[model samples]
Structures are given as structure tokens and as C-alpha cells.
Target chain A: MFEHFPQRVLVNEVVTRDGFQSEAEFVPTATKIELINALSTQGLNKIEVTSFVSPRAVPNLRDAEEVVTALNRNTDTTYVALVPNERGCGRALALDLDEINLVMSVSETHNLANMRMTCAQSLDQFARISAMTAGSAMRLNGSLATAFGCPFEGLQTEDTVLHYIEAYLEQGLHSITLADTTGMAVPNQVYSLCRAVRARWPDLEVTLHFHNTRGLGLSNVLAALAAGMNQFDASLGGLGGCPFAPGATGNICTEDLVHMLAEMQLDCGVDLAGLLTQSRQLEAIVGHPLPGQINKAGLRTDTRPVPESVTQLRQSLEA
Target chain B: MFEHFPQRVLVNEVVTRDGFQSEAEFVPTATKIELINALSTQGLNKIEVTSFVSPRAVPNLRDAEEVVTALNRNTDTTYVALVPNERGCGRALALDLDEINLVMSVSETHNLANMRMTCAQSLDQFARISAMTAGSAMRLNGSLATAFGCPFEGLQTEDTVLHYIEAYLEQGLHSITLADTTGMAVPNQVYSLCRAVRARWPDLEVTLHFHNTRGLGLSNVLAALAAGMNQFDASLGGLGGCPFAPGATGNICTEDLVHMLAEMQLDCGVDLAGLLTQSRQLEAIVGHPLPGQINKAGLRTDTRPVPESVTQLRQSLEA
Candidate 1:
């Protein structure tokens, strides 16, 4: 039981990278930069500016360098980027970025499907990349994807998932996260796995990356919190997904996360209203509506009373 | 902290009653009956059938009596209903109700705004209703609305909110719930308040009602659970809210909740697929796009790989 955690939650903004990457239309580099800049002012600690994957693989993120390079970094904020392999890691390193998130799936089927390699091969590659980044000030987050459940495989067992963690930890990747890549995780699974992982690696910093797939993402986060895990990965407006993964919808919306955290009286440090404002801007830029609920319905304090006309209309209908 | 909770989570389905009441559409009595019948088969333990409030007050739920009368009673499920006054209570008593939920607001302003009564007056009315059903087998749940914060008063103090609970317990209401009527609760507040309430009424059945108004509904529930509180009220597809409470978005979606609990290996007794099916039916009946996410995004196990055409198109666009 997390009897005493810092009464604060961290909102990692991934709108620019994750939100935009999933869009069919390419968001202009300038708009992406503007989004990041707007997010920085909104009191977010980390903004996933872009992914360093090959432009051919992910066309939307071709301007990763420009996006990261152009960000107005607040001293308190950290700028992170997702890197797939050595080539991508090299690009992240060249930027002297605040953090580099290296991701791989725990399930072999997803691992092979996602990264074109088996678990062992991906771990070996991670080990090589870990060795390359040794002694660097830039932080590295080794992310275990499909840690919850997999598309190809039914349920991801803890033993198989934790086996991957052993490799990452052995490689000196101290900070890591277990992602519900396809949003297959539930609260009990999160509780048991997080508890088991925490018991094994007490010193390791664990972040949870959840998708609102199946709509249990935030509940899974709560389960993790109960199991003593604090750090979480969320995208603004609940954006982002693996284009290859079917129905791998949006991430846990950032504003929703912060709004919940703030209401829970946790000091997430992110500005709730400002995030809502930025989320509105995000929706405007995207042209299509984002999935976040808080932005659509303003906070409680701002609610205007239902006008008498609407009330009378409702009343007459009821009559 | 919640090490002793039943591994199986209890999902109280409030859709037929709570969900439909929030919408302007007057769901037909037959449709409501069909909706509940569909939900009962979906592994839901407790499904709130309808509200017995005066037809004049809530035209949407005017058919509550007929809907409850039409339910298939063979299933080992608790069919509950919301009773607002002695008249509603009398109507519920006529039926074979398993449980009756008596609703009230904690904040004075909302109490007046919602029920046209002062807190004292509402409690007095509750006392009369309690007296009327004193010896009945039906379970009574004393629900304290705006327990976390109120739309009218802005931020509600814990002291003020708990005072209402103290009053309800005084009136012999043992099963009670603290509701975030406007989604004003943060996690720490939820944890601390749940702990405090538990400390006072150790035997009180504490159920939490959270709104996703600011997107903190599940997070708040998580905090309460961490504080060793269980039993939550959720609507299907995140449906239901105070139509009177502007900006009050949706209830914590039931499918979303069950998805989280079951995924955590905590049994919610809800057939995930069954719940989704019912949710789909409800959406079709409403004839509007539902706010639910999981239904549109197929299960996480559904990895039919994004079509080759999409990948090729995406790749060509990138090129």
C-alpha cells in the first residue's frame, strides 16, 4: 500500500508526438512547435516533442529534430523523445535531449511484429544502446510494451513480462515503464504486476503507459498507485497509438489525468485550466475533435446554470 | 492499503436509472426494460433499474414502475432503484426492490437548487422516508451528493461534507456513499476523506459516485480504493449526469470500470463482452454517438493488424 506518496502526479504531455503522429493529415512543423510551446507554458513537466523513428516509417515525425530543437524549455520541464533503435537513439543523443524513451514489447509476438525482432534480440539491442548511452547526463527510460496483454497473445503473464524487465535492469536502465501498448491492462493486473515488479526491483523507478483501450486506462493507473508505482505516461487530449495495432486508440488523456490528480489533491504541478486551454487549441488545430472529456465539459466551477428556456423545454417534455 | 478487499470488484450498474435520467430523451418503458434485461445477463451484480421520483419531476424516468415490473427476476442480481421521497419509497416498497437509494446533496446551495429544500429539511424528509421503510427487507443507501465539491458553493470543505454523513448515520442510514457530484475531488482528498469516513463509521458500506466532469473520476475512485474503500457507482458507456448540473459530463463508465477491475485480475462479475453488447444497444436506442471508447475500439486482443493497404498508404504518404 502506498501509505505515503508525494501528493503529486506527473503529467507527461505527448500531444505533439503521439497525438499528431496518429493523424492521417500531417500537422505542419510550425503547428507542432506551437503545440509544444503552448504545452510548456501550461506547466507540464515533460513534453514528448517527437519520435526519432525513420521518417519513412513514421512520416508525421520526420520533423522530430526541428520540433525538439525549437522548444522553449522551462527549467523545471523535461523534453523527452521516443527512440526505436540505435539509429533513432543516435538522433536523440545528438539533440542532447532531456530523456530518451526506448520501447520494446514483452510478448514475443508483439516484439516481432512491432520491432521486427524477438524478445531476446530486442533486449540485446537495448543492452547495446544502454552501453552506448553510459555516463551520459541524458536520462534513458527503457519502456516495456505490451506489458499488460497482447493482440497476438491472449494475456501477458507476469513471469514473461518481468523476464524482459530483468534484461533492461541488467543493462543499467534504471528508469523504466510498463506500457499497456494495446490498452489490455486492468486494475487487478496493474496491482499484481506493479506489486510484483516493485517487490523485485524496489529501487527501480516505474512509469505506467496506459491507453484508454477498453476504457480502463485510468483505473489501471489507480491500481498501480495502490501498488506503490507513481510515475505515469499520458498524452494531451488522450492522443497517440500504434498505427499497426488494430483499435489501439488514444492514450489516457493528459488533461483528464491532471484534472483527476489535482482534484485528488495531488500536486501534479501542471496547470489544469491552462492544460484545458491548450487542449482546446489542440482540438482546434487537429480539426477533428479529440477524445478528452474535460475540454468538452468545462470544470464544475465554470458551469452556467441551464437556462430557464432549456429547463422549461425539459419540463414540458417531461409533462 | 486495500489488501483485504474482495478480489472481485462490485460494479453497480446505474445506467437504466442514472444514465437515462441525465439525457433529454425519454427512453420508452419497453426499451428501458430491455436495456436492464440485457445488462442483467452481462455479469453485473447490481443494476439500478430506475428512479421512483415523481414523473413530473423527471419525465425521463416516469416509466420507472413499469420497467421494474417487467424485469426478469430469476437472476441472482440485486435490482436497485433511487427513491427521492416517501412517495417514491412507497412506490418502491410495492415492488420487490432489493435495494433503495435515497439521494440528497451535502451542500446547502445544491440541496436548495436540486430539491428546493434546506439541508435540515432534506434530512427531515429522509428521516420520514426512513421511518416509512424501517422494517422492510430492502436495503437503503444514503447518498451524499456534492461530497467532494459543489457547483453552487465552489469548493466544499471535508468538514461540511462529513457532517452530512454524520447526520445520515444518525438517521439509521448505514449504507452510505460520498459523491463527487461535480467532479471536484482530487485523489488525495478522496483518500483522506474516505479514510476519515471509514474511521468514523467503520461498518458503513461506503460506495463512491464520481463524475468525469474534470476527467478525474477513475483517479478519485483509485484514491478511495487505496484508502480501503470499495463499491462504486458507474453507468454504462460513461453515461448519466445531472442535467441540472451544467458541465457535469458523464458518470464513470461501467464498461470502463469493469474493464479495469477484471484486467487487474479483480473480478467484477461482469462479462466484458456482454457489457459492451448492452452498451452498444443503449447507444443505438439513444440514436446519438455515445461517449464510450472501448466499444468503438475493439478489444485489446483484437490485433487483426492494420490492413496492408493502410500501411502502404501511410508509407507512401511518408515517402
Candidate 2:
């Protein structure tokens, strides 16, 4: 089973766009730029810098253009952004972005609730964006939120996700992300679904976005890895959460994912120490402690000295 | 891969014993007894009620004998307690404990730190306890703390654990627990070690103890499960952390573990809602939010109604 792992995995950072959007108090554009600049140089494969959504809908990310424009973008890191409609996609295309993540939900109820549009309507939006972006160098990622299980609906079958993937392919998108928008995925469910997705589209690039709401995020990551998934979406300092799913936490922490990957001896290519430093900075910027555990508990190799009290007790016992 | 799972995994609850032992405020004896009584009836396979160590050392569980004597223990649940030496074993033998966990550390430094003794000395104590428990029905579980990793030392190899386990069998101990004392375990290490342990001793009732320090607790559980492990030790409300490992959190949460298992459709045989209730009550008793996520996040199936805001937005869009 350990042999099943690839030589390396790709970790796509989504903190600036997905993480910051969830915060009610808007982060300053400069701080967003500074954070992205710091993280981009840390060997991350990709960074979703900002979103081109309506300012009225997501006011926090109103400075999408400014953040992307002001970025001290690293050459090695691919820059990405989330786009919800034709206008958003057009905004993303105008920028020097490497990828545009078009978002939707497989569950009709979730699609209606999250996007205020039916699944069919969202597909139409995607089709229009794809038609306009034809022959463009910018990549497109069709992110299916609640691909695992929906809060409004229940568990989603692999077939349900595949059905959405079919539509995604029909719209000319080559890459897709199965987002556990509410952290409703279990290990076997993720393994089976990821296996099914790979079996259907061997050439497709699949990224898994998980929430630690129920604390199964990393476990689901392992399941995905077993089923030949090498791409993941994580947030720095464990930022961003599903506002509709009251109890759901944020995206899986970027530093912690890197730490786990490093421990497993899989090459994630991210500088974990740099990520942890940024996570600490993120805490100060967010004005609250984030959900990441590795930042709290240092690396496994970081061995602590035996406490003075324990040493004295041991000495006394020996005496 | 899914077919490798057992019909049901045996979850051993260790809140009252391991969790409360780390609490700064000593829980009142009655509260400890009440919590134990409440949890014993919740379909748990076993419950480690308390530690029979010197009251002066673990002041929180000073009323170990009293708590054990007073428990309204259910017939269906096997009652367990941690016992370190001859005296603690003697104390447990006088009570109604179904199993007495003989604790030790596979690493030399940890044994000296935690038990104020060397590994050899701890083994000698276990031998003495084994001699005393001869002809007794009370089962003994050799718990190898730092079996996965040590805080003062570092990552422990499976060989070191196997060496200690071999000694345990020599002392007539049939069951063993591989404790990740500082939550340093990764999935491959866990899977590899668990596979090694199972291969060496097929019939040994192996129980895995994990911590969420690095946030790989459940991920490690998935590894152990893949390695054919069916017994896990979890703390209610995610109580009981590594005192030596500064930022490390508590044990793998009982409710969260059960939630993941139930989601995988693996029979954990735990009452989820009942555990949630106890976890909430525990929070009130401990006077703080616990490290557990399920209590804060709720189960995946415990979906919320579509928010009135989302509904209004959808309605306005439709109109």
C-alpha cells in the first residue's frame, strides 16, 4: 500500500481567495498581497490568489484585481482565481492568471442555495465562459462543491459526481475538483469516488478540497491518494469555511497537509517551515487562532527536552 | 481494500482515565462516577475508568478505587483502568475492573520521564504485577506509551515496540496498545508498523492510541484500519493530551472517531448522539471548549435547514 504512493503530490494553496472570503472583517488588499507574495515563494505548486465574484456578494474580495495586480508573483508558482460567472471569468482572463476555477455544486439544492442558480443555469454560465476563453492559455478548473455529500441533500454517489463531470467535460473543462464543501466525506466514499473518477477520465486532473469540520479531512486525503489523486486544495492557517454549514470548519490547513506529506515521505514540494511561519502571521492578521494543529504542535522531529520537574523526579527516584 | 475491515471495530473509551488525568482541575469524585456510569451504557465495548497509580502522582484520579467501586457499570461493557506497578495492580484487583492496563514506554527516555523508571525497571514491575495477578480473572493490557513516538526521544520504530511486546508476552500479557504519546505518527508509518505488528502476532488484540497533535489522528486511524486493526482507544470530548509535548492536543476524539467509522459504514457500535451529549456535559464540567470537533461541528448527517438568508436570496433571484 505504501508503494502505491507517487513520487510527489501537488498542493494548491486557496487561502487568499477562499479563506479570506469567509472572514467577515475584510483583510486589507496590501495584507492579502503580502501574504500571497510570502507564500508563493515557498515552493507551492499553485496559489488561488483571489476571486472575481461580485463585490456585493463577496465584499471581502472586492480588491480582486488589486491583489492580483500588486502580487510579487513567483515564476515557479501558477496563479489561480475563483470565477462564478461570465463577468468573473472575463475579469480573471484579463489578469495574468494561470487558472480560473469555475465553481458549482452537483446537488441541485446546494447549487440553488449557494449560487442562487440552478445546476443547468450554472452549466450555461460555464459554457459561455469556455466559449469565450477558447484557445486561451489560461487553464480552467470546474470545482463541484458538495461533490461528496450535501447538507441540504444527503450523501452523493460517485455516479452523481460523474454526471457533473460529464457536463464539465461537455463544457470543455479538462480539470475538476471534487470539493467536500461541508466536510461530509468518509474514507471509503472518497476512495470509491476518486477511483471512479480516475477510471472514467484517466487524463483528467482531479483536485480534492476537504474541510476538517467532522475531522475527517486528512483521512479523506489519504483515501484520495490511494485512488491515485495527487492534487489537493488547502488553506493557510486553516482559513475559510462553509457559511451555510454552521458547524463545518475551514479548508484543510496547508502547513499541516505539507507536514503530513513530508512525514509520509511524499514530495509535496512546499516549504513547510515557511508555511508554518505564514500561518502564525495569518493568525495575527485574522485576529484569531486558526484550526491548524501542526502550527500549534511543532514537527515530529522537533523533540522537546525532558521537563525540569520530570528530570528531578527521575533523579530523586534513582537516588 | 474496504473488504479488509472487520464486521465492527471495538472502541475503547479512555476519557475518565486518560483524559481526566490531564485536567488541571480535579473532577469531583461524583462527577467522575456519573460520567463513567453514563458512558458505560452507550454501547462502548470497553471503558478505561481510571488509573490506579499513587494518588499523589495523579491527583485528579486519586479517587480511583472509589470511582471504580461506585460505577454503575453495565454488563455489556468491559471496565478497564490503568495500573503502573504492583501496588496499583493490587488496588485494581480489589475493584471490579474487567482489565488492568499495565503502562510502559518503548523508548528509554520516556519511561524515565513518565514512570520515573527505566524500561527494564518498568518491565520488572510488570513482571511483579503479572505474578500478583496470577489466578485472577482480571485481564492485563500492556500499554506501550511512546510506542509510535516519544517527545523527549523521537519517532519510535516498530522494532522497539515489538521488543517490548515480546517482553509483555513473556510476562503473560496477551493484549497491547501502541500509543502515539506525542501524535508524531504518519499514515504510512502507522500502516507499516500496524502491518508488522499484525504479521508478527496475528492473534494479539492490538489497540492503537493516537493523538491529534499534528492533526493526523484520524488519518492514522484509517491506516490502522487498513492494516486490519479493529481496536482503538479514544478520549471523550478529545480530552487527555501529552503534557510533555507542549502544543500536542488530546487523544483521537471518541465521538469524532465513531462519526468517521459510522460514515465509512463500518460498525463502531457506538451511540453517536449519546456520545455527543456526554461530550457537551464534559465541556461544562471541564469549564472549557474541548479539542474535539464533532461536538462543535455536529455530525455530517446532522444537516442544517437552508438559511433564511439563502432562501430570501434564492426567492429574489427567481422573482
Angstrom error at residue A252, model 1? 2.0
RMSD, each candidate, Å?
5.4, 1.9
Per-residue error (Å), model 1, residue A276: 2.6
Top DockQ hit: 2
**Model 1 alpha-carbon miss at residue B269, Å:** 3.6
Question: In model 2, which runs have C-alpha deviations exceeding 4 angstroms?
Answer: A307-319, B307-319
Per-residue lDDT of candidate 2, residues A236-288 (tens digit): 98888877555557899998899999988899888898998899999999998
Per-residue lDDT of candidate 1, residues A173-192 (tens digit): 76888888777776767888
lDDT of 1 at A114: 76
Candidate 2 per-residue lDDT, tens place, B1-319, comes to: 5667777899999999889998899899999989989998889999999888888898999998888888886999999888888888889888868899988889887887778788888888888888888898989889899888888788887778888899999988869999888888999999899989899999999999999889999999989998999999999988987875665588999999999999888998899999999999999999987888888777788767776767776688789
DockQ of each: 0.31, 0.63
